[model samples]
Target: MSARLEVRLDDERKQRLEQLGEAEGVPISEVVRRLIDDAWEEVMRARRIAAVERMAQLEVEDPPDPETLSRELEETYGPGGLS
Candidate 1:
């Protein structure tokens, strides 16, 4: 389902949107939709970045030993020895 949206833009912004639409071979509405999609993607990307940053700041207690992790990896992926 699609709903209609009415936005009031200044003359300068309107001209810019028109030029962008012309350059992209699309209508002004298409340009607005693309802009909205781009904005939404940026918001989602920011959320992911924030989540990663939060996780990075966390201190994990009792972390597993590197040697144990290596042994487990080798067990799961098999030895690198030539058969």
Candidate 2:
């Protein structure tokens, strides 16, 4: 399915979009869509990084034994899996 979006861009931004589209041999709409997708990916990547940092900073009570974790890793994935 296809959808339509109507957007109003300032003259400068509209010109830039037109220039970019011309340089890429595509329509301004395509350029805008690509820019939107790129921006979305950047935002998602930042969120993922923040989540990982938060998880790293978390303190877990009653943490598992190192030996037990190693054994489990080895059993699940064979030798060198502990790394």
Candidate 3:
């Protein structure tokens, strides 16, 4: 399903978007969709980075030992399960 949105852009911005669409051989709506998708991807990437940063700040008790993890993985999967 698709949703419809009516945005009111300034003349200059609308003209710029129109020109960009023309140059790219696509409709202005397509241009706007691409811009919105790119912005959404960047926002998701930033959120992932923030999550990693938060996890790094937390202290974990008895995190598994790397050697033990590797050995368990090797037994389950194959030798050098994860090199």
Candidate 4:
């Protein structure tokens, strides 16, 4: 569900938005919603990218090698290890 929003813009901005909406064959509100949604999507994408990069950094700081892990497990438990 969505609620109605009433915003007051300067005359020049309102006219420009109206003109753009007309050229795009859509309502001014739709044009504004599209612009806002696009900006929000970009922000979210950047945040996700930053989170992935942070996770990569953390992984590099505490890395686990498969070969060393296998050898340690075999030495501790048995030849077949946990399997």
Candidate 5:
């Protein structure tokens, strides 16, 4: 099943949609559908980005200190430290 949306655009925007539809030889509804699809995709992409940023923040909240890691690396390898 599919849902429906009803939007009201200003005169200039409506005219632009109409012009684009005519130029592409498609109906205004198709233009609206494509625009809505693009908008929804952008919204979801932004949400995903926010989620990833939050996860990274949580993961790095108490990350390993740099000096300790360097010491461990030096112990594993000799003075050159794997070049």
Candidate 6:
């Protein structure tokens, strides 16, 4: 139930796609389709992860103490913490 997709590529990109398809033992169209599918899966996975994180953040109960929270923030944003 997939529709046909017509794309215009520069000669160099076309050659590269052909070479990649040959190396992978698949048709160029299949290579493109797989790449697109993989990208879509990655995007969906990221969205799911973000949604879960947002839900967890929303589930927090009482507010953290300011001093403890500041320390935690300093620790998190300090030398050996998440960027």
Per-candidate TM-scores read: 0.73, 0.71, 0.69, 0.74, 0.59, 0.65
Model 1, runs deviating above 4 Å: 65-83
lDDT of each: 0.91, 0.93, 0.94, 0.92, 0.89, 0.90
- Runs of candidate 6 with Cα error greater than 4 angstroms are 60-83
Question: How many clashes in each candidate?
Answer: 0, 0, 0, 0, 0, 0
Which regions of candidate 5 deviate over 4 angstroms? 1-7, 60-83
Write the residue-wise lDDT of candidate 5 on 1-83 in tens digits: 76887889999999999999999999998998898899999999999999999988784556569987788778999676789
Please say which candidate is ahead in lDDT: 1 or 6.
Answer: 1
Ranking by lDDT: 3, 2, 4, 1, 6, 5
lDDT: which is higher, 4 or 6?
4
Candidate 6: tens digits of C-alpha lDDT, residues 1-83: 87998999999999998998999999999989988999999999999999999998885678689878778878879854465
lDDT of 3 by residue, 21-81 (tens): 9999999999999999999999999999999999999898875799888888999888957
The C-alpha local distance difference test score for the whole of candidate 6 amounts to 0.90
Backbone clash pairs for candidate 1 read: none
Answer with 3 or 5, whichever has the higher TM-score. 3
Error of 2 at 45 (Å): 0.3
At residue 25, candidate 2 shows an lDDT of 100
**Sorted by TM-score, highest first, which candidate order results?**
4, 1, 2, 3, 6, 5
- Candidate 2: list runs displaced more than 4 Å: 61-83
Query: Which stretches of model 4 miss by more than 4 angstroms?
Result: 59-68
Pairs in steric clash, model 2: none
Candidate 2 per-residue C-alpha lDDT over 12-72 given as tens digits, one digit per residue, 9 for 90 to 100: 9999999999999999989988999999999999999999999989897775799998888
lDDT of 5 at 28: 94
59: Cα error in model 4, Å: 5.2
Candidate 1, which ten residues in sequence have the lowest lDDT sum?
74-83
**Each prediction's RMSD to truth:** 7.2, 7.7, 7.7, 2.6, 7.5, 13.5
